[model samples]
Structures are given as C-alpha cells and as structure tokens.
Target chain A: MAVYTHLGAEDLASLIATYDVGELVSAKGIAEGVSNSNWLIETTGADGAGARFILTMYERRIELDDLPFFLGLLDHLSAHGAPVPRTIHCRDGDAYQLIDGKAVALIEFLPGVSVDQPTPAQARAVGAALAEMHRAAHDFPMERANTLDIGESLRVLQHCGGNALATVDPALPEMIDHAARLSAAWPQGLPQAVCHTDLFPDNVLMRGSSVTGMIDFYFACTDAMAYDIAVTHAAWSFDKSGGRFDRAIGRALLAGYESVRPLDPVERQSLPVLAQGACLRFVASRAEDWLETPVDALVTRKDPMDYVRRLHFYAEAGDNPFHPAAD
Target chain B: MAVYTHLGAEDLASLIATYDVGELVSAKGIAEGVSNSNWLIETTGADGAGARFILTMYERRIELDDLPFFLGLLDHLSAHGAPVPRTIHCRDGDAYQLIDGKAVALIEFLPGVSVDQPTPAQARAVGAALAEMHRAAHDFPMERANTLDIGESLRVLQHCGGNALATVDPALPEMIDHAARLSAAWPQGLPQAVCHTDLFPDNVLMRGSSVTGMIDFYFACTDAMAYDIAVTHAAWSFDKSGGRFDRAIGRALLAGYESVRPLDPVERQSLPVLAQGACLRFVASRAEDWLETPVDALVTRKDPMDYVRRLHFYAEAGDNPFHPAAD
Candidate 1:
C-alpha cells in the first residue's frame, strides 16, 4: 500500500551492483506489494537501456527463513514455464541477500495491468493461470505448511473474541464460531498441492483477456487443492465491496480450472464448506488486522465485513457444493 | 512520498484515450510527489512500446487557479529549450480536466535520479537548471506572487504561537521571531522573476553529473530571483539531518547560477537576509505541517527544527553574507 522505507540513489546503486544487472539509472518506489518495499528499477547495459526489474526489500511481516521457500517456489514455477516472475540471483548465485539489514531480492518485472473488477474472460484466464501454477508447483521440493489453517483461524478468532468486538454485536462471534464448527467437521482428504493462498484479483496481472503473471508468493504454501480452488472462487466471484457473489464469474472460473485439471468427486463435494472456511479464515484475519493495525501505520486495513458477507453467501449454498456457479 | 489514489485499469484506459498516447499497457503508482497522486504510465504505440509518461491528479493541497500558471510555466520553459517537462494537452486543447472530481493532467516522464546528499557537480547542475528555468520563465504570461513571503512567515509564526509549541521551548519563539525580523528587513525590488520557490534536491533530477530535469512546479511563483537562489542554496548545501551546511556545494551552486545570469550587486549583498528568509519560510511551513497533518496521513512531515538550525546558520552569517560558503 505504501513504501515504508526510503532508499537513496547512492545506497541503491551500490546494492544493485551486487547483481549482474547493468548500471542503475533510476529506481521509483511503486505502490504495489503491501508487505514489502518494491522499487521499479531501470538500468543500462552494453545494449543501452535495459529492461525493468522489481527490487523488493522484505518488510516486518515476512519472516527471513520463509523467503527461500517463496523464492524457490517462484524459481520452480518459472522453470516449469508458468507465467510467474523468476527471482534474479545475485552475482554469488544466491537469489536474495541482506541489504541495510533487510532481506532484499531482485525479480524479473512482469509487464501487465491488474484488473480489479475483472471481466468473465479475465476471470477465466486467471483461473487457468492459477491451475497452471498449482500444477507447475506440484513437485516443488521446498514445502511449507499452510500458516492460516483452521488452527490459526481459531487462534485469531479467540484473540478477537477477547477484544471489544465481543461486546459489539454478539452475533459476530456466534457466526465465526458456527463457521469454525462447520470447518472442523468438513472433509479434508483432498489432493494436497502447493497453492497460492492469497490469490486476490490484485495479485494476478492481465493483458487484455490473457493472464500474464501471478505475483506475491509470500503466502504460498502446501494446502488442500480444493481449498485453494475455494479460495480462488472467493477472490474471483466477489464484487469490490466483497458482498455480492457473481455467478457468471464463478462459472467461468470453475470451467477454466476444470479445463486444465479436473477435480475429483470428493473435492467437488467439499466446495461449499471449503469456501465457507476460506471466507471464515479471511474474516478472522481481517478482524484481527482491523483491531490490531496501528492507525498511524501507512497500510490499508481491509474490512472484515467483506468476508462476513462471503461467509453468509457460502452458508446459503448449504450442502449443494457446486450449486448455481460451479455446476 | 505516497500514492493516495488507486485507479483501476478500465478507468485509466478510458482516460488515456483522451490523449494521443497509445494503448495503455500499465499504470504503476510510483511514490514520488506528496501533494498529488502520480502514476507512471506505460503505453504501446503503433511502433511497439511507447515512452513512459506521468499522470498527476492534483489533490487537496494544490490550488485550482495556480495550476494554469504552473502548467503554462512548464510549457514556457520547455519551449525555451530548458530540460523541463512539457504539459501534455488533451485532444480538445485543454491542458487539464477534472476526472472523478480531481484535476488531472499528463506530463512527459523525465528520466533521472534525485540526489539528496548532492556532490559539488550535482549542485552546480541543479543551480544551472534553476537559473535556466528562471530565465526561460521570465516572459511567461502567468504570474503567481510568492505565497510564503515575510508576511506569510509572520502569519505562520503567530499560528504556531497559538499551539503548544510555544510551551516546549521559549527559545523556539525567539529564534523564529529573530528570523522573521531578518526576513522583514530583506531587500526589496531586486530583479523579480518567475522562480522555483521549492527547488529542493528532490525537485531536481540528475544522471551522473548532468541534470536530466527539474520538476514539481506547484510552488513556482514570481519572486526575487535572488530569493530563488537562496532557496536553491539551502537545498544544495544542507545535509540530511540538516545540521551542517556544505561550503563547497554552496560555492558550486552560486558559480553555476552566475554562469547563466550573474547576480546584481544588490542581489549579492542581499544573500544572507534572503537566505534567512528562505530558511524562515521552510521553518514556518514545516511547523504548520507538523502541527496540522494528521498522524494517519501518508506524508513525511519534515521537522521544523531542521530549518530552525538553518536559520541559526544564516544568523551566524549576519552581515558577513558570503562567509565560508557562497563566496
């Protein structure tokens, strides 16, 4: 949402020299990635002006140990020909290094605009891309378990329950409690795969109707394949306010995903509960964020109510997992 | 310093069509200007990828009337062969238009890095650019009086006088009072010209030893040409923490200005007072900004004490205006 750290030209130039990249011409702190400081850097090589690349300095929210997993996953996906950014290694072959006491890396800049209110075709493209990414990352050696599983969701819910939220609208806690209960009883034994846990519309880049790149792999982890599909459905099927679910977008998305890799009967049957769980996870995290984030900090705190409405939508779908959208 | 607005692709693409710029490929909100929302837009022309341009949406701080003068001054200087960006007019010949209730315009994106801790050569380049801008803007039809004059400084002082700032240090008021007195006694009627009042290092871009462009003309106004030089000197000479003023940088800047248009005898003699006035202006504005800006707003409110230190430096110079530095 904002560039938390300011990098001077001299400091940036010296840092860029650690890579085999060309002479640094300029770097502009672009407002894209929220958890890290992202600068769009331009350099000049023997051929004159070179291509642009993103120089990212991982911020506080990202753990240092988890970086290798994310970077390796990007490399693995890229090597397998998925439309994902390849992390550019340093002169010493390390993909990232500490600069000014923060883990920093340069990645090949993906050229495309992100569609927020995506069209059906764009949603379909994103669905296919997500499937491609999941397929490509299947054999990625470095594995990290999902951090925001039901366990973490329950933890956050308890944390939120202690706060003043428990006082205002008692039904809020009741709803989250009911969703957690449903998630606890839900079917889990689906094909396990590496999934982009945070596949929001803003994270997917598109050029016209084609998906050019998928970014922000910090949240990537090994999770249930159906759960990943459910998350993607939650992201793509909702409006900006995150209230009304668009069936056309959900239909196109599911069709596109199935076009690449067909879902098993058990996975398909778990869609409604999986979607509810996904929505519940977001609601819990966002509620925590809304309560915890410092008002002075320069980050946009997403409304927890968006996911609340999503949970309501999924609850209405009941046991008819595929329902009006995916069917 | 931060991008306040987020525009979707569809809205931006429609906006791009109003101009002759090619198909919009992407628009990244580059964190540069604090007063306005700026996006670095890339497009693809008939011959493949086109050049990058800056799209600015004037925010609350900038006055509506002053835009024409600022835009026209850029046009004037650009036409006079100065290395400044020309305001790109719309298809209907309007330089700007209201979009989503905000005044928006496109300008050619200037390529270069901004040097905060400037070397002597970079100081010279910035000084030369400032002089060239003043010379080029002399005949510009639009005229904007200096907003932060001695009177304005007095006004801000009185305003700050009302706040709890007066209770912190009694000496605070005295220092500002003395600086205001010095400013009040500044020489009058000394070669009035269109001056880039806020010609800080951040406003001037450089590549190697050469200045690629001068930008952010929202503060440009007709004032004592020597006053502008004084402002530029304050920018080029100071360190980041704003304690020590570099003599070498000041010498190079003055020399560079003289190469373009030599300062008159009166202008040369009036340096110390004008420098004090410039310092006072920043002190007053920064004081107001510090007191007024909400802690939540994504703006870097510069410490007023920095200019307070500069005021002390100028006060020590007394009548020996060209002591150790400008001479």
Candidate 2:
C-alpha cells in the first residue's frame, strides 16, 4: 500500500545491471501490497528499448529462508505456463539481491488492472486462474505452511481480547466465541494443494474480464485447495465491506473453478463451514491489525465488522449461493 | 511521499478518456512531492501506443484557486520552450477535473531521475533550468503571492517556541533570534519574476549532466528571482541533513545561473541575507513539521537541525560558496 524503502536511482540502476536488462530508464513506486515495496521499472532492453518489469523490496513479515520458496514458486508456476510473472534471476543466477541488508528482486511486469467492482465475468476469470495456479503449482519442489491459518487466526483474535475489540466495534468481541465454534467444526482430510491463500480481488489483475496475472505471492503456501476456494468466495462474492453479497459473482466464481478443477462432493458439502472459517480468519486478523497497526502505516485498516457480517451470512445460509437461485 | 487517495481502475481509465491519450494501460503511484498523490500513467496512444503522462491529484497545503496558476505556469513555460512539462487539458478544455471533490490533472511525463548525490555538472544543469523557467514564466496572467515567505517562517518558528525546538535540537531555539536579525536586515525589492522557489536536487530531473525538466511547481509564485537562486543554492549546494557543503557544486550552480541571466550587482550583494533567509525558511517549516506532523503521516519528519546547520554555515560565511576558491 506504500513504499517503505527509499532506493536511489543509482542503486536501482546498479541492481538492474545485475540482470541483463539494459540501463534503467525510470522506476515509479507503485501503491501495491501491504508488507513490501514495489516499483514499476522501465528500462532500455538488451538490444532494443522499453522493457518493463516490477522491482520489489521485501520489507517485513517475511524471513530470509522464505525467499527461495517465494521466488522459486514463480519460476515453477510460470514454467508450467501459468500467467504468473517469472522472477528474473540476476546474471549470476541468484534469485534475489541484497541491498543494505534487505532482499530485492525484479519480476516480469504483467499488464492489467486489479478491479474494484468485479463483474461476474471478472470473478469467473479469477476463479479459473486460481484453479490454474493450483494445478501449475503441482510440482513446485518446495513447501511452506499456511502460517496465517485458522489456528493462527484464533491466536491473534484471542490476543485482541474484549477491551480492544470494543474500540473497533461492540459486536467484534462476539467473533471470539464464533471463531471457537468454527475451530471445532473445521474439517480435515479434504483435497489439498499449493493454494494461493490470499487471492482477493486486489491480487488478481484483469483486462476486460480476462485474467492476465495473479500476483503478490508472499502469503502463498501449501494448504487445502477447497479452503482456497472458500477464501476466494468470501473475498470476491461480496461488496468491499461485505455488506452486500452478489449471488451471480459467487456462482460464476464457483462455476469457473469447477470448470477447471471440479470439487469433490465432500469439498462441496464442506464449503459451508470453510466459508465461515475464511470469514472468521479475516475477523481475527483485521481486529488484530485494527488494534496493533501504527497510525501511520500506509495500510488502510479493514473493519473486522465487515467479515462479521460475512460470517453471519455464512452461518445462517450455508451453501445457498452455490446452488444459484433463478433471478 | 505517499499516495493519500485510492483511485479505482475504472475511475482512472475514465479520467484518461477525458484527454486524447489512448485508453489507460497502467497507472503506478509515484512517491514524489510531499502534499500530492502522483501516478505515472501509461496509455495506448491515440495513434500509436505506450505514451506516458503524470496524473496529479492535489491533497493538501494547496488551495483550489491556486491550481490555475500552478498548472498554467507549466503550460506557459513549456510553450515558451523552457524544459518544463505541458499541462494536458481535458476534452472540455478544463485545466483540471474534479473527481470525488478533489482536483486532478494530466501533465506530460518528463524523462530522467532526480539525482541523489548531485555532481557539479548536474547542479549546473539544474541551475540553468531554474533560470530558464524564471525567464519563460514572464507574462503569466495569474499571480500568486509567496505565502510561505520570511514572515510566515518567523510566525511558524515563533509558534514552535523553545520547548518544541528542544525536542528537535536544543540549539534550534537559538535560530529564532538569528531569524529576527535576518528579518530586520532583509533587503527590499530585487529583480523579480515567477520564481520556482524550490529547485532542490530532487525537483530537477536529469539524464547525466543534462536537465530534462524542472518540476513540482506548487511553490511557484511571483517573487524575487535572486531569492529563488538563494533557495536553490541552499537546497542543492549542501548534503542531505546539511552536514557538509560541496563547494564545486555550489560554484557550478551559480556559474550556470549567471550563464543564463547574470545577476544584478545589488542582487549579488543581497545574496548573503537572502541565502540566510532561505536557510531560516526551511528551519522554521521543518521545526513546525517536526513538532506537529501526526504520527501516522506517510511523510518522514525531516530533522530541522539539518537546516539549522545550514543556517549556521551561511551565517558564519556569507556567499563564499557562490564564488569558487581555487583548489
């Protein structure tokens, strides 16, 4: 959401020189991602001109050991013909470079904008891309746990306590109780794969309802594929604050997912509890961030109550939206 | 330093539509300017493709009525063959458009980077560009009073008082007395023009030793052109935090300015006080910002002590840097 690191034009040009990309023309800091800084880099190509890429500086919430996996996953996925951008290795074949003790990498810049009010067509394209990413990540020769899962969510939520939740909203403290119920009902032994756990609308880049790129893989990890669908459903099927649900977008997203990778009957039935867990996961994290984030962080703190509304909807309705009632 | 507004992709594409530039391909938020949100916009050119522009959304510290003067100054200078960007008017010929009750405009994107550690040649180029801008701005219809002048600086510094200055540096309070002396000695009426009062290294975009454009005109107003030189000298001739002075860069900058338009003998003699006034101007504002800027502001609170050190340097030896001492 903001550029935290201030790299000079010389440092950037030298870093770009590490690769085969010609001289740096311009680098503009992009307003994207919460935990890292990104720049849209334009350069003179090796032979011609106007080659563009994304330069990212890893800032926080990621460790040195995780760099290989994160950068490697892109190489693997893009190798499998997914629309994900490839991590451009340095001339020495290293995945990332260290500058002032921080890791930075150049990535292929995939064109298209992340939608705000995603149409049914856009939602469908994103669903299809998510499924494709899951398939493409099949042989990605590495593993990282879904660290921000239900257990992590509950831990963070409990830390918020009743007093802090009261500051955000009166009803937020009640999510602690509801989270416990979801934790108990949370299933095991369903279909699983390397899932893009945070595939919100903001992550999927689209051009006229055609999915061009799925980006920001810092939160990506090995997890239940069905749970990934649940996260996407909870994310894209509602208005920004989760106040209103769009059934068409929901059905289109689900159908698009099924068209590529059909869900098992168990996966279908589990959607009810999974969506609730997805919504609760947000409730816990948003509440923690609301309490703990510094006032001046470039991030916009999301209201925990937004997910609270979604959790209530999932709790009461179950899988009604998936069936797609005729309008 | 950070993007304050979040414009949707649809809103931005439509905004681009207002101009004859093609459809919006991408808009990357640039970390430029303290009080405005700027995006480096790339469009599919109306005839060809890949035309670039800068989209600016004014956020704070600038009034709506002042926009015409600011935007029109760029138009006036560029039309007169100064190395400045031209304002791209909307289809209805409006200089700026209102979106969500905020003003935004498109300007030609100039190529080159704002230098970090500027070389003497680079400083010289910026000096020439500044002088050219001052001359090109002649006969600009609109007039804006230099609001943040010596009087305003004194007012802000006085408000900070001893306690606030102590927080920044114990010596900062002593600047108030020095500012008063400079205020009393401040000479009246030197040669005046539309001055780009902020010609810092960061404001002048350069390709090697050549200046591509002079930018960030929000501070432009009808004022003493020599005072503008004083401001630029103070800004570019010192290192960041004002710890050390670069004599070659300082001499080159002044020489470059004289090459364009030689200073009046009266203006040359007034350099000492005008330069001290320039130093005090920043010390006052930075101290006020250091005291009052909110904790969560995306801006990094600059050390007022930086400018205080510069004030001391100018006070101890007036205008010596402008005249080169043989090595």
Candidate 3:
C-alpha cells in the first residue's frame, strides 16, 4: 500500500482546471500498487453530473518516456471494449500531463474487487480478461521493449547472489543458474502482440467470477502474446505461497484464454519454457526488491523463495498441464 | 498510510454475509490515516442498490474495550444530525466484530474533502462541527477517561526527555519543562462533556466552507469541553511549522464555536492552559512515535518539535487569543 506523492487541495484544484473533467470534489489516496501514487478522485461534471476517476502520479520507478506507451495502450484497449480503464483526455488533447512535476493521468474508475486467493472460476475469468486485453491491444501503435527481459533478469539474479539473497535462502545461486539456462535457450516466438506483462492476481478485478477490468498496465509492452498467457497462468494457477501448483486452475485459465484466442500449435508447445521465464522474471524482481529496497521504505517485498519454488516446479514438469503434447 | 491487516476475499465475503449490506463489489485499502487499516468498501445492496462504506480494522494502539464508547458516540452524534459517520450494525445487531483476528467495524461513507491546511472559513466550519458534536454527545451514556490527561502528558514528556528527542532537537527539554508546568497547573472544574479529543485538520471533511463530517473519534473521551475547543484550536489555527499562529482563523473558530454554544467565563479563562495541554499531548505522542515506530513503517511520523514550538508560542503569549484580556 503506497501513496508516494502528496498533493494539496489548491494544487489539485488547479490541476483539475487543466482538464475537461469538472470541479474536484474529493481525492483520497488508494494504497494498492507499489509503483505509483494513486488517488480515487471524484468531481462534479460541468453538467452538474457526478463522476469518479483514478488519478495516478507516476513515481520514480516508472520511466517518464514510457508513459505514452502505457497511456496509449490503455486508450487503445478500452476503446476496443476490453475490461480496462479508459484514460480521460486533458484539455490539450493528451491523456497524460504533468502535475506538481510528476506525470499525472486520469482514468475512469473501474469497479470490481481484487482477491488474494481467487477461486478456480475467478482464475478463469482473469485469464479471459488477459486474453481480451491482448487481442484488443494487438494493433496498438506504440511499442516498448520489456525492461526485465532475459538479459536484465540475469543481471538481477547476479545482483541478488552478491547481496543478501543467500542468507535468506542458500538455494538461490542454483536456482539462478536454472533460470538463466531456460531464459538463454528460450524458444523462438510463434505469436507476438501487445501484452500485459504483469497480470498478477491483484491486477485483475472480479465480480462473482466475471471479469470486470484489468489494471496496472505500466509493464505493458509488445511481447509474445503466448508469453502473456504463461505469465497469467503463473499468476492465477499458483497458490499464495507459490510452492504448490494447482493444475485444475491452470487448465481452467487456459480454457478461458482459448475461448477468446486459441493458442497456435507452436505457442502451445512453448508454454513450459515461457512459464519458466515468467517465474524467473518474478524471482529476480522479488530478489532485487528484497535486497535493494531500503529498510525504511513502505513496501512489502514478497519472499523470493516463493518464485524460486515455482521455478523449480516449472523445471521439474516435463510438459505444461494446459498443453500436454508438444506440437 | 496503513493496511496492517490483510483480509482475503473469502473472509470478506463471509463477513459481508453476516451483514445485510449486499454483494461485495470492491474493497480498496485507503492510504490515509496512520492509526488503523482502512478500506473503502463498495457493495451492491441486498435490494440491488449500490453503497460505499469505510471498513476500519482497529490496530494495536486502540483498546478493544473502548470501541463501544467510540462507536456509540458516533452513533449517538449521527443520530442527532451532527456531521459524523453512523456505525452500520450487522444483522446480529452488533456494530463491532472481528475479522482475521482484528476487530473491525463498518460505517456509512461520508462524502467531503479533507484538506491539509484548511482555509480560515473551512477552519470555522470545522469548529462549528466540533461544537455541534460536543453539544450532541453531551448526554452520551458511555464515558472513557482522556488517556492523554495532564498526568499522562507529564509521563510522555519525561519519556521524551530520556529518548532520542534531544538528538532531533536540543530545545526539547526546555519545551518539556514548560509543558509540564502548564499541565501540572491545569485549572479546576469548568464544563465537562463527551469530547472528540483529536480534531486534527485531516479528521474533519469540508464541502466549500461547510463541514460535512468529523471523523477519527478513537481519542474521544470524557474531558473538559473547553479542552476540546483548545485541542481543535491548536489543530486548526496553527500552521504546519507551528511557529506562527493564525489569529484571524483562531478568532473565526472561536466565533463559530460560540455560535453553537457560548463559552462560560470559567471555560474562557481556562483556554490558555487547556491549549498548552493540547500542545503538550501532541508533542509527547509524536516524540514517542518518532522513537518507537519501525524505520520501515508506512506511516509518516510527525516531528514532535512542531508541537514543541507551538507549546513555546502558547507559553510566551501574555493573553489567550480567545480571551483578549487574559495573560
């Protein structure tokens, strides 16, 4: 839970005036994501109607230049009817602008609850939403290379080993080697499209097993769409501890994804390695956060061992449960 | 900003079932206050109506037995049309219950914006609301003693002297001495009532110049009504640095309070000492928090010296601003 930036009422009122959105009624910081400061803002429309929105102030971690891709992707996907927030345009015909020296954007508030441990049905709904977002953003004009690609993952893993990771878990070095091997030999991609790179369970909102929306598109980039499926599977099919895999939920999520856009034979065959890469991505990121983040930071870093165990599960499995046969 | 207790969706759903509120739609952890975990909960009502409520999970600092007094005071005040959140009772007729080993309660969501540095008009509105609440809660059946009374203040002052407070500011001891003197010489009986002991700027919500609500009554207790005014005066009439007092706002606040219930001569005479006591309470508590809170806590510990400076200003002033003739 974080709200890194604080804005005063007068500053907020002036910021609101720069947009077509009406008078600011209230803005309360929401402690959800770790990447940026988010506030739930309410305004009275010029027509005297009421509206609610989410005002995001990009923090230090996010690259300012990359915001256009994130905002444009949301704009493109929402226009295509995907379950995502629609960016509210500013008076200057841009969805993103500067407020108090930080890049700020407003998006319509999406209504739905994010669960810690989703039921199998809810897992499938999330899978369906990811697929929907992937399809919707396929033709998005912007492109951003994944910052934490295989090479970056290797760097993070090395950093973790040199730092305090071994003290936390002695198996980290060996796990890094295994992940490096899989990432180095990653299969040739069969399908590429816009993808939500970090579709964690908390990013998908559900209402009674129905997908309401997908949020936190900061990591969205042009990547192998099948890799997105693998990431979402890792997100939804894994238990909270990530030590155990739920095959039933994995199959359900795959089925949900297939309902929208079926995986081609090559894509299906690459699921295991892709899943390994996804696990490695999280493992390295979590390790870095655990080692690098200041003790005084208001962030709760996930245990890297959780992803370490998940990577092991992926390594031990000869074939993906969702795609049993190589194509 | 705190969300100390994390509740899973299944637990939340079951908890909602115990109430007639409705189907759970969403629950976002609100990053606002430092004392408790707060979630902005939305539900589709049992009758298919939509509603939003605040779900507060009481943290360790709060006493469980004192919850009845706090919740009952809100209930009583809101029932009498004072601007405060009404506690929502569960189907079992209890307003307080436990979820995930943490005591929790749901209250109706009041709509208004809370500001950091309130305008003079806004400060007056807040003062009016505080006065209204005091009048309405006068006959409240339950009573809790002010935990930060003169004796407690002296103890906290002593604790501050022995801690790292000197490292933060060398003048702390002198300020502590001054505060101790005022607290030890607190005036004898004036008007007493159930008071909202902490009426900080962030605790009051405003729409334009009108106060929409008063919140965070965890500190409410049986105390001198004049002391409550003094506490609020300290909260609203002082700048963040606490070095300079805004006399116009202070006068406006006193006028607003007098509009609802006039201050007796005895109460008026007690204002200076009471205000001094209020400053001391915040100074000691903030010092304790600064010394004890973990470095990684999500909370921002207020500088104790801000209150110390305010205590100094209160000490040096020959006349109470509220009582022009008194030194």
Model 3 error, position B194 (Å): 1.0
Residue A130 CA displacement from its true place in model 3, Å: 1.5
What are the per-residue Cα lDDT tens digits for candidate 1 across A1-327?
A: 678788888888888888777788877888877788999888884367586789999988889999999999889999998999999998899989997789999998887888878888988888788889889988998889888887778777877774445543444676557656875787767898899988887888788999888999888899888888899899879886677878888878887888798888788888888888898788788788777777776667887778878878888876443644434
Model 1 lDDT, residue B271, Cα: 89
Model 1 residue runs over 4 Å out of place are A166-170, A294-300, A319-327, B167-170, B293-300, B319-327
Candidate numbers sorted by lDDT from highest down: 2, 3, 1
Ranking by DockQ: 3, 1, 2
Q: In candidate 3, residue A293 scores what lDDT?
A: 71
DockQ of each: 0.62, 0.56, 0.63
How well does each candidate superpose onto the true structure, as a TM-score? 0.95, 0.96, 0.96
How would you encode candidate 3's per-residue C-alpha lDDT over A1-327 as one tens digit per residue?
688777876677788888877788877789877778888888887576878889998887888988888888888999999999989888889888887678999888988887877777887777788788888887888888888777678888877674366766787777667767876788875678888888887788778898888999888878899888888888878887887888878887887888888888888878888888888888888888778777676667788888877777877784757663322
lDDT per model vs. reference: 0.82, 0.85, 0.82
TM-score for the B chain of model 3: 0.94
Q: lDDT per residue, candidate 1, B38-134, as tens digits?
A: 9988888536757688999998878988888888888899999889999998889988999888999999888788876788888787778878888
TM-score of chain B of each: 0.94, 0.96, 0.94
- Which of the two, 2 or 3, has more DockQ? 3
Best by DockQ: 3
